[model samples]
Target: MGSGPSLLHREDIHVVIAGGGYAGIQLAKSLKNKARFTLIDPKEMLYHNVGAVRSCTEPGFAKRILMPYAPAFGQNFKQGSVTAINAAEKTVLLSSGEMVKYSHLVLATGSTGTFPGKLPDEMITVAEVTQKSEAVLKLVQEAKKIVIIGGGAVGTEVAGEIATDYKDKEVTLIHPRDKLVNGESSDAFQERLKEVLQGLGVKLVLGERVTNLDELPTDRVETATVMTDKGTEISADLVIPCTGLKVNSTAYKDSLASSVEDNGSLKVNNLFEVQGTERIYAIGDCTNIPETKMAYRAGMHAELLAKNILAQETGGTVKEYKPDPFIMVVSVGRKAGMGQKGSSLLPEFVVRMVKSRDMGTGRYWKEMGQKPPR
Candidate 1:
């Protein structure tokens, strides 16, 4: 709402942030000095609320989770989606055909996927999240048998949300892997969720492959069906796919192709600076930072980037971003959750209270410098 609390170093130094997600907005607000900032994103609100993954099954939280971006960054926030980046020229081209020049550029545009949670592109407005949440609530209300593909965080959370909200509805979570959140969560952590999901009456279809979500047929009977590779035909009132999210790496693949992986994720050195570039930096889902691509890790990347960029300008020391030991949560419902911080296991009651209750919804509003929930 007010001027950045820190002092801008020079009048000429400008920081152009690509996405208005957690990292982009954090860097914009944290930067000090006379440094100018231009945050570009098509969406009017920041949709980092993972709580909405479950809350959308309910009516009240489904509407309250999407926070308006206008309140996050006042005059510095721009309305557009980035189409291209010129590391040599130090400029970013917007989809609107406008070129924004910056002394230092930070790309925080997270990944996109087919799911409603994975945005198709830079979003058009903040209202879209609210609309999707409302529609999902309606879907849950009418659907009798709901099936979620991928037992990862999103699918499991959705199952928990729907099962918790509508006790009578049949919910199922199918994962091709033996364990949930295979590369991310520990085995003990996944076991805890398996218990929670099954306890809530969610059918578990683990270690089974669903060939293609498209081939799944839904006839005039108003029911959904998908055939598994195991030759088991699964039927449901609703089928949702939670996999398939590729890195949004196409923007720099031409000139900086070597610096990116096959997955479209840009490679960076320890400093979070995009390799082979001087002033350009990439963070969050787009970077190959070896850690889980969650909001908390993105915030850490932004903090390190802000510090390092400022140090480069002010002749100070820059820090490298090594993800702090694993800290994650899985919300089975607003009343149930499980997670671990470092080597310590989080109790169900604490998880429920700290995260599952409001899914850290209020704290995110505060992160954006908005009014706390009433």
Candidate 2:
């Protein structure tokens, strides 16, 4: 059995997870019979952002991705933003003026990114997300020419999803680097991604910087002329900025005696524990794990952290978390994608089955102990 029944029962071994994201939810779920857990987050639902880019094009997808924490976690889940961490006192200060005590602390606070890729930073409810999805779908439907200012995973995915779904729409992807995936992926994988996107009629503008990118508005989809640094002008009806992510590690700064990296990531040891603290640990995009900040990688972190935490409690063999090699599965649209693991690129069929088909929503729904909608 999971921790649902023993959530409030076992107060002695209480585990407080700061962020109810991919890593946080997985960690809490993995500690089924081990400890009682309280998951804290500002949002009511766990937005499966891996599939968020696709949601822009597909209608009613936002409701499918935005999963509530109530089903699996029940009363143990606390809906609030973690304002600060009182490490000395072992309590997490919430924005709701509530102090949640913990015997073990896991800082799984994930990073923040722009809309359609990542949700808005403000506190969100399920109803609001559904409304936003409908609005974005309408925006995509009306847009004849779409410009995505970033050729990263989010940007490429956005371009692919929009272009694939609406063949009449002119989709252009702009990236600062000469190659896609920021030169992090293998040569073959990058080439494949470019080929697939181009096949879908996505215009690629590589090795060019969007000078007026910061000035562009992200709130509402608008008709504007986007100018690049190289004097190229593109008229766009809808401009989506895949500006990347910023780590949310403010709560760890004041109370915890640990070094926060210049990139705002928490420095964690090989055991996934914060450098200075024994009981306190950090994982996911918020930790300097030297891996791609993907949802799957965060899930991997939770799996290991759960075992290590159990080992510490039982005085058993504690294991070290070795950073996995750069493994990525970039879903282009429903039918096409590219992926890489170590030096080898994944098969197109594998990519389609694993990610491109439904953006792995079914798998995640199962992981969260819920049934995927038919």
Candidate 3:
């Protein structure tokens, strides 16, 4: 009864979701019986991107990192790269040379990266995740020295995961800033993170920049040696860049009616509706939501968008989105993490219990109506 022949026979109030990320699928499942939904993305599997850092280092965990979408969504899920979106007409064009029409559209194509933040560019299947995860593990296994650029959440967490798994390897973390995790966190939290990472044998090279990536001498595609701004030369068998998120915003450029942000996200009103548009809404990393881009925030946005859309259908008063206090967490390794929940520094045990134990992937699978990997 979730989605199949019975649902297809019903009349269409088509809701086409342009991405299979957390926001897109959450809205689709929440609005299950309320509308005819079509969720589209290029990858055959919906990614638990947060777990990729640890999964890359501990390749055995790859089995728990990916889930195919077809099982959860049935026939309503479409696997194809969205080439374009016609926001005015509420239609999406896929790479399969097919056009999907909709009465409502929600764009939630979350940010991606060139590194472990997302899967490799050519990888689109669950099997590819496993294969590439093993390849990444091979890189970790083969390298005696590892260099991580940026001291943000992903970079720091990756460093910890690698150090935890391979204690013999020399791991160096370089950042231009004086402290790690500078955004939306306190100095106490930053100091604690520094202490934890340093205790794990991660060399913290702070307050300096690795400014010349192109000039680095490469031993291989995975290995390089570079000079820092302070004239220190560091050589590593593997270099990983977790610089930041790059919003995937080019697809809807023509359709967004000149309201796209310079950073490749759409500008939206407080209700999470795209500015100057009525039927079209935007959420998650693809929107200028003014909050730190986190999975929980995206889930809240999806719920709010669904509620407002449902209200618009039934002629009821639409509810505005009011977010809970910001909670920030970083999974240092499989059993360790650091976090702050609303101005209180969470204890290490609390961080491990909440996120680092399994990276919140089980809860995500539960919401998606799938069994977690054993």
Candidate 4:
């Protein structure tokens, strides 16, 4: 894998990218013209997880978010999972028992979390997600009192959607941290978010840990009595947990065992290449890049990785990757939200205009080379 006549041809360069989430798709699209590429994922449709929170209350919204991969990648996309990576052989084993060879392998397998924040592995299609949302909506409608565990962005959004849609239902959001979003946001942003959620009839129970919540199943809406460390018992017909995300790195663990971090994330250098491996890279939420895991950051990783990969083929100097400043905008129903850009807190109207209106669904649809629904 040196600079030679074989490397000069773009068609001869095969870049195999694992995962079809934000980073994988963006990287594949960026390298489509620069090299021969293949994108592998377990699912056929690219679930726009940003809009998944809104889908629980809004009927028919799933169609807009869950987009088909065929339109974007065509034959270059393979609907399967990357079971194992053989860096020594320069190939990968797919779950379907097929061996796909590659000139460069990019490990962009993102993290997995609970529903609404992230889709389950079993839900591999738009239809499955749509059906699940419809079912959750039914539970939301029928339940008298609903409880959401965790005060992260996902939990806050879930509480907001349920409260906004069903004003009569008693909605309570419980968090171990005093401030919302795990207290990661600024004071101004957190205060404003609390005001917005309270205005929507959502009860805030902060700085209280749900002691028995770990024993309950969070995949579905179940009736349970959750007790807090402060000796408070809140009974609800529906309970949802928006917990932490687990990194998806099983494919790389066996062959590149030493590259995996203590937290189960892959160790990558400033160039976005997996540490101790040449031409094998990792990006998105799966990498141990010291920054908040967000879709925008993953997109940024894709842009830089594409440039570096192309630069390497031409024997050009590779640029080091730098993470952008922390930025986040959370949607609270359709018209309300909170955001922070760098050290400044964004105004409510700006947040709505940029994200709260439609959670940036149209932008992603356009990014996939598809026209957004009118």
Candidate 5:
């Protein structure tokens, strides 16, 4: 009834998507019918980390968040990480000793948080973090005191979720700056976030420099006591460090004509393509795109790149990727959040109604071709 079967029989278009995260999966889906796609990722499943913060409170959400690639893309899925990329050869070398050739390559390797890269390779996915979530939750469940080191959205959300859900827990958010949600949000937005956190019984430890983690116990269920530069110790049973993300581009560092920024993100061109490379493109947290590394933006970038690549192949005008100005919707736990659309700070109710309720899980489910559960 459709040209899909007939088109599948022909092998004209070949696309290789590295890193089956937000950007890679969406881009692969966009070109699934039009091209022969090979999705490569170290993990067998595609993790939706948009709801990662909420997963700390709702553990069951973890299963729904991680969507497997094999079911979504069929034979196109390849279970392995890309060890290297050869722009000249237009091929990607896998960790499994297999080399896959590509007509076009998309790097959507995403990123990891400020965790030291000392952990074994096996525990890397959202599942690993989710598995640790319960242990972390157990600490929170028993802890009378909690200290969140970092005042970003993730840190704020973590503090809020804990304070709101587990009211018994004493949560204290420590930031090195004078105000919370620095750089990403406006002053008004930061004030609102601080107000919300304070209202929900979270101790706003602002203008404090954490010199060291002195009283963090050696046991698994231990408190995180941080010592300030002024020799003041703020102790808590649980400490969730929400620093920044580190882009995963080490594999392609030597192979491609790529330049890393001061923050370690790869610099890409207007077309989302890595500079000086025709067949290669970088997206998501890995690229130094002038945007917040959100899942929605990554999906948008991937879709744009896939369309442009297909257009280039078929002799159509290529579309350029101009990132929309920074728009952040941060949830201060259930039914409360702060959003900044460009420079405009939307009301807290607007943010809550749009994003805070479900952590954008419904949007992700629909995008991934799954019917969101009622």
Candidate 6:
């Protein structure tokens, strides 16, 4: 209630972070000691969705997967979505009809994948996403014939989780390309993934694109089928679409300093700041930063941006952001997984030991400044 820990008084250094996911939260933590921070998000907690696929198989772990903001920051958080932003005015209009002013703004608004609509327009908050994820888990539990559409990380992980855990259920992974995780991963990694899937008795349907989903009979559980471009019908009782995500840059569309990409990502300069704009930055999947849209990368971007902004405020030269090479640690269940570390493809057993064994609870513990399990 009082003016507590005023690192910035009378608009000294007010950093208004737009999203409280990995990027925003990491940025907030990085600057918590140096600035008066206000973190805004619609959800009360952060969904650590990197471990979400595993959570589907082990439903009880969901509680441990979420990170709450209030406990992490004392009285520096707000629960509301930013409905609009006026860059010229340096103000963010919230869904609660409150306008928050900022000297520097970090647009870590992130992205949406499952929602089939415009970015932010059809956006579901973290809470809703988690709830829907629970429903998805339940659906998987009841489903006998499961078909996952997309061969990306999320899709592959989902398929692997279902196939390895639900042995009796018929699982099939459908991809438009000939190999899973097509362009993002190495050939060795792809082959290893296919081998793991085959070992788990998971069927792989490749080189086919879904053309129709309405042609299947409605009565039988196995009657639900997808017609591919190759004129093949693949049947399933449940269909999970993990295609891709669109950046949430609608609020920044009209801002003079920001540019939107064809895929709906915001264009940011080398400093991780939105180009053509002063004191405004964008990070994570919402920005065209030439890196994988993983949580770790977002956190790194936010950390660099926070330091650069602080240096700028002190009349020091801003730091340039160097993105790390993409690394993928994918799980095939609790005991097996695969990893692409920098350039080398490793076995699933190594990946499981590094990531999947604890479903990243150890990572969360470390992020929260706690010691990981022994």
Best by TM-score: 2
How far out, in Å, is residue 187 in model 4? 1.5
TM-score per candidate, chains pooled: 0.92, 0.95, 0.93, 0.94, 0.90, 0.88
Off by over 4 Å in 5: 1-12, 114-121, 124-130, 214-219, 371-374
Off by over 4 Å in 3: 1-12, 215-223
lDDT of 5: 0.74
Using TM-score as the measure, name the better of candidate 3 and candidate 6. Answer: 3
lDDT per residue (tens digit) for residues 1-374 in model 5 = 12322234447567888888889888888878777889888876766566667666765655666666776788999888788887778888998889998878888888876321112247556568557656656666777777778877678788888888988888888887876665867888887778888999999877777776544542355646678876778876666667655677756777763466666667788898777777778888899877777777988898788778766766677888888987888888986898888889988888887788887777767766776443
Clashing pairs in 1: 7-32, 7-33, 8-33, 8-34, 8-35, 9-33, 9-34
Candidate 5 at 154: error in angstroms?
A: 1.1
Encode model 1's per-residue lDDT on 1-374: one tens digit a residue.
13423337477788998887778877776772346788887878777557668645766675556677677777788888777877778888887899989998887877876544565564466566666666667777877887788877777788888888889998878889888864567778877788888899999988898886785522222476777888877778777677756776545667577787888888888887788888888988889877767887888788778777767787777777677787777788888988888767788899888778887787788887887544
Worst 10 residues of 2 by lDDT: 1-10
Q: Candidate 2 on 245-312: residue-level lDDT in tens? A: 89987678666644688888988888887887758889899998777888888888998888776666
Top-lDDT candidate index: 4
Score candidate 3 by lDDT. 0.80
Per-residue CA lDDT of model 3 for 1-374, tens digit only, reads 23322233446578788888888878887777666888988889878887878786765788787878888889889988777877667778887889988888888888878557776557899888787777777778888888888888788988999998899999999988887865678888888888888889999998889987666432233556766899988888778777767888756877674778888899988787778776778888898877778887888889778777766766767887766776788988887799887888988998898788888888888878999877
Off by over 4 Å in 4: 1-8, 214-223
Instruction: For candidate 2, list the clashing residue pairs, or say none.
Output: none
Per-model root-mean-square deviation over C-alphas: 2.7, 2.3, 3.0, 3.2, 3.2, 4.3
The model with the greater TM-score, 4 or 5, is: 4
Tell me the deviation in Å of residue 147 in model 6. Answer: 0.6
Ranking by TM-score: 2, 4, 3, 1, 5, 6
Candidate models: Cα lDDT each = 0.75, 0.83, 0.80, 0.85, 0.74, 0.75
lDDT string for model 6 (225-335, tens) is 677898888778877777766677655665532377777777788887777777888888889978777888888888788777766766667778887776887777777
List the pairs of residues colliding in candidate 4. none
